[model samples]
Target: MFCYQCEQTTRGTACTTQGACGKTPDTAALQDLLVHAAQGISQYAHRLGKMGIRRNAADAFTLDALFTTVTNVNFDPDRLEGLLRNAAALRDTLRADYAQACAAAGQAPEALSGPATWEPAPDLAGLVAQGQAVGIDTRIAALGADLAGLQELVVYGLKGAAAYACHARLLGREDESVYAFVQEALTALAEDEPSVDALLSLSLRTGAMSVTVLALLDGANTGAYGHPVPTPVLMGHVRGKAILVSGHDLKDLEELLKQTEGTGINVYTHGEMLPAHGYPELKKYAHLVGHYGGAWQRQRSEFDAFPGAILMTTNCIQQPAPGYADRIFTSGLVAWPGVTHIADHDYAPVIQAALAADGFTDESPVRHHLAGFHHDAVLGVADKVIEAVKGGAIRHFTLIGGCDGAEGARSYYTDMAVALPQDTVVLTLGCGKFRVIDQDLGTVAGLPRLLDMGQCNDSYSAVKVALALSEAFGVGVNDLPLSLVISWYEQKAVAVLLALLHLGVKNIRLGPKLPAFVTPAVLKVLVEHYNIMPIGTVEDDLKAMGLAA
Candidate 1:
C-alpha cells in the first residue's frame, strides 16, 4: 500500500510496503477502497444535484464518508467494510435517481465511471492504482501516485474541515454552504479529464470551506465555553486516578469531563487538545489536568510515561507502543482494532479503562508545563500589543508554525528561529514549534520573542491575533507588519492554509517544499491569487521578508 499523504511518510517518500503510521497493507487498501466508494457516492450526488436534490443531504453523505478515511482516524476493518457498503448503497440510490431523471428528461442514461463499473480484479489493484494515480495518470482512467497524492492531500484537508464542522454541529451552529461545496468538490475530484486549473480551484475551495468551518468551530467553542481567557493550566502531575485525552475534539473532552465529573479520574489534555484549557466552559472542570505529551510524534514516549488511560479523539495517532497499548482508548473517528473504541461518544468504557489501568496511587505529584493560549486570550492583550507596536517595543509579529515531520529539511525552521532578528517576535503553534521553540530567541523590548500559541488547531489563535492587530492598526492584515512563514506536513495544516487564504492574508511564505500533490497550475493560482511563496534558505527567505541576515 503506497501511502504518502502525511508528514511521517517513510523516508520522506511514499509508504510503499507498510505505513509509517502503523497502517497495514490490508488497511491501506481498505482506505483506498473507501475513498473509491466515496467517489462513487460523490458522482451520484453530482448527478442528483443536477436532477434537483437539495445540496445539504448530498454534502452530509460525502462529508462523513470522507472524514472516515483520514489517516489514523478509522482502523477498524469491520467499521470500514460497513461504510463501504453504505457508500455503495448510496451510490445505487443516486444512480436510480439519475436514471429516473434521464428518463423524465427523455435522454439515455449515460454510464457513470467508478466502482459502479468495477469488475473482479485478479490482482492487488488498490495500491497499483494509488501509485499510478500519484505518479502516472493524467486523466481519471487512473490516478497517478502524485495527483492521487494531491487529491488525497485535498481530501485530507477537507477531512480536517469536516471534523471541525462536526464539532461545530454539536454546538447548534451550521453552515449549509460549507457542506454543499465540500460535496461538490469531492464529486469534482472524481471526474474524468479534470484540469490542473480545476483541481487548483478545488484546493482554494477547500481552503474557503476551511475558513467557514473554523469560524463555525470558533463560534461553537466561544459560544458554548465562553471565549478562551489567559488561564494557566498545570502541567504537573496530580494525585488520583487519571485519564489523558488527546487530539483536538473538544466535544469528546467535554463528555469525558462530564462522565468522570464525580469519579476519581483526573482529566488531562494531551497534544492538540492542550489549548482547550483557555475556554471558560471546559476549564470550569477543576479535575481537568494539564497536558501529558509534547506533540503527536512523541506519543510513544509520552504515553508510556503516563500510568493512566489515554483517550484519542482525532488524528495524529501513531502505531501504539506496547508500553501504553493496552491502556489506550479511542473515541469518535479514531479507531484501532482490538483496542476498546467508544462509539457514539460514550464514556463508560473510557472510564472503565481509567479504572482498570490503576491510575496514580498518590494524590498528585509535580506540575510540568502550562497551556490554553488561544485567540481570546491573545486578544485580551490586544491593547498592550498595539501599544507595544506603537511604542516601538514590538517591531513585527511573525507566525512561524505548522505541522512537524521527520524530514531533515524541516530543520530549516530551527534555522529560521535562530536567524530571525532580535526585534521580531515569533508566534508559533502546532508541532512545528519543535524546530525552534523553547530556545532563547531573546525578546522584542520586554515581550518574549517566541510565543507558543498552541497546536495546529490553534492556528485559529494566529488568525485571531492577526485580525485583532489589523483592527487596532486600521489596516488590512496583509498590510500589517506580520509575516506567516509556515511549514506543513498533514491535512490539519491544509485547513489552516485555507483559513489564511479565506482571510485574504497574502504573501505568506510556505515550505519545506510545497505539497507534491499540488499540480503546477494549482500552484500558479495560489502564487498569483494569494501571493503565496515557497520558503527558501533562512538567509534568502529572511532577505525577502526584509529582515537582516
Candidate 2:
C-alpha cells in the first residue's frame, strides 16, 4: 500500500507499509479502491455532460466517496468497501445514462478506456487487490513521476473542493459548476497520458472551483448560523456533564446542541469547532458552553483526559484509543473501526454517553479566547483597520493559518506568531490556531492583534478580508502588507492553496514541509509559476516578508 496525500506521510515521502495517521495497509487499500471507483464514475459523469445530461443528483455521492478517502477521515474498511460498491454501481448507471443520452442526441457513444470502463471485484480482498493494481505507485510507474504527480495534484485539489462543496450542499447551497469540475478533473486523471501543461491548467482550474466552493460554504454557514462576531469563549470548562464536539462541521454541532438543550449536558467545541462559539445562532444555545482541547492531533490524550462523551464531526479524526474509545462517537463522514458512528446525526447516544460519564466537579478559574473575526465582523471595522495601517499603528499582517499536526516543526508557526513585531496583526484559522490560541497579542488601535476567523472551512473569510483590504488600499493583494504562512496537512489545504494560486497571490510560505506527492520537477514548475516558497526560520521568513528586516 502507498499513500502520500497528507503532510505527515512517512519519512516526508510515501507511506508504503502503514500510514502515519494510524491508517492500516488494509484501510489504505480500501481508500485507494474507493477513490479509483469514484474516478470511474466521474469519467461517465463528465462525458454525459457534453450531451447535456446533468446528474447533479449523483454529485453528493461522488463528493462523499472522495472525501472519505481524505487523511484521518473514514478509516473503517467496511465503510470504504460500501462506498466502493456504491461507486461501481454509480459508474455503471452513469455509463448507461451516457449511452442513452448520446442515442437521444443522435450521436454515437464513444467507447471509454482506463477507469472509465474498469470493473471492480466483488469482495473486499479482491477489491484490495484491484486497488493495488491502480494505486498511486502504479500510476507513477505507468505515467512517470512528473505527469503522475501533476495528475495526483489535480485530484487532491478536487478532493478538497468536493469536501467543501459537500458542506455547502448540507447547508442548502449547491453549485453544478463545482460538481462539473470534479468530474472533469477526475476524467482527466483517468487518461493514460495527459499532457503536463494540461494537468497544470486543470489543477489551477480546481483552485478556481475551490474558491467558489469555499464562498458557497461560507455563505451557507453564515446564512444558517449568522455572521460570527467578536465573542469571547471560555477556555475553561463549566461544571456539568459535557460532550466535546470536534472537527469543522457546524451543522452537526448545531443539531447536537439543539437535541441536548436543557438536557443538563454541556456541549463544548473542540479542534476546528472552536469557532462555533462566535456564531450567534449556535452561541445562543444556553447549553452550548465552551471550548475544550486544541487541534485534532492532540485528541487522543485530550479525549482520554476529558471525562465526558466526545463527538467527532467530518474529517480530522485520528484512531481512537481504548482509554476514551468507549465514550467516543463519530458523526457525519468521520468514522473509526470500533467507535460508534451516527450517520443520521442523532445525538441521543452522545447525550447518553455524556450523562454516563463523570461530570466536571466544579468550575475552574475563568480563562477566555477571542474568536469570530469573520469577514463581515472584520470588515465592519475595516475603516478602523485601514486608518491604523495608514497611521503606521499596524506594521504587517501575517496569516498563520491552515491545518495543525503532531510533527515538531509546526512550532514554527507558534514562534512566528509570538515573535511578530508588536504592531503586526495576526490572522489565524483551522486547527493550527492551537499553536497560538492562547497568545495574548493585545490590540492595535482598538483592533485585536490576533484575529480568529473561524475554522479552516471559513478560510474564505480570510481571503475576502484580504481582497477587501487590497481594494481599500488601492493595491493588488500581492502588494498589500500581508503574508500567508499556510500549514497544510491533507487535501483540503491543497484545495485552499490552489485557490490562492488561482488568485495569483504569490510568495506564499507553505510548511512544515512540502507535499511528498509533489515531485521536484512539479515543484520547480509551481515555484516558477506561483513563486510559492518553503517556510524558513521565523526570523528569516519574517525579514523576507518585511516583518523584521
User: Which candidate leads the pack in TM-score?
Assistant: 2
lDDT of 2: 0.88
lDDT of 2 by residue, 76-137 (tens): 98888887777778888888898888888898988888777767787888988888888889
Cα TM-score of candidate 2: 0.98
Clashes of each: 21, 0
- Per-residue CA lDDT of model 1 for 1-549, tens digit only, reads 566666666765668778777887767776777666666777766666666665455566666666676666877766766666666667777778778888998998878775454432334444335423423123323654445545765677787788777767767888877766766776777665555556656776788888778777777887887877656667556677889998888888998899899897899888778778887789889899776656677888989888788999888788788988888988877778878888877888778878877676654456533345577766776787788889987877788888776667888888888888787888888878767754777766665677777767556767777877888899999899888999887766777887778678799888787765564665676788999888888898888888864
User: lDDT for each of the candidates?
Assistant: 0.73, 0.88
Query: Candidate 2: where is the Cα deviation over 4 Å?
Result: none
Query: What TM-score would every model get versus the actual structure?
Result: 0.86, 0.98
Best by lDDT: 2
- Lowest-sum lDDT 10-residue window in model 2: 49-58
Give the lDDT of residue 473 in candidate 1. Answer: 91
Task: Give residue 272's lDDT in candidate 2 (0 to 100).
Answer: 90
lDDT of 2 at 350: 86
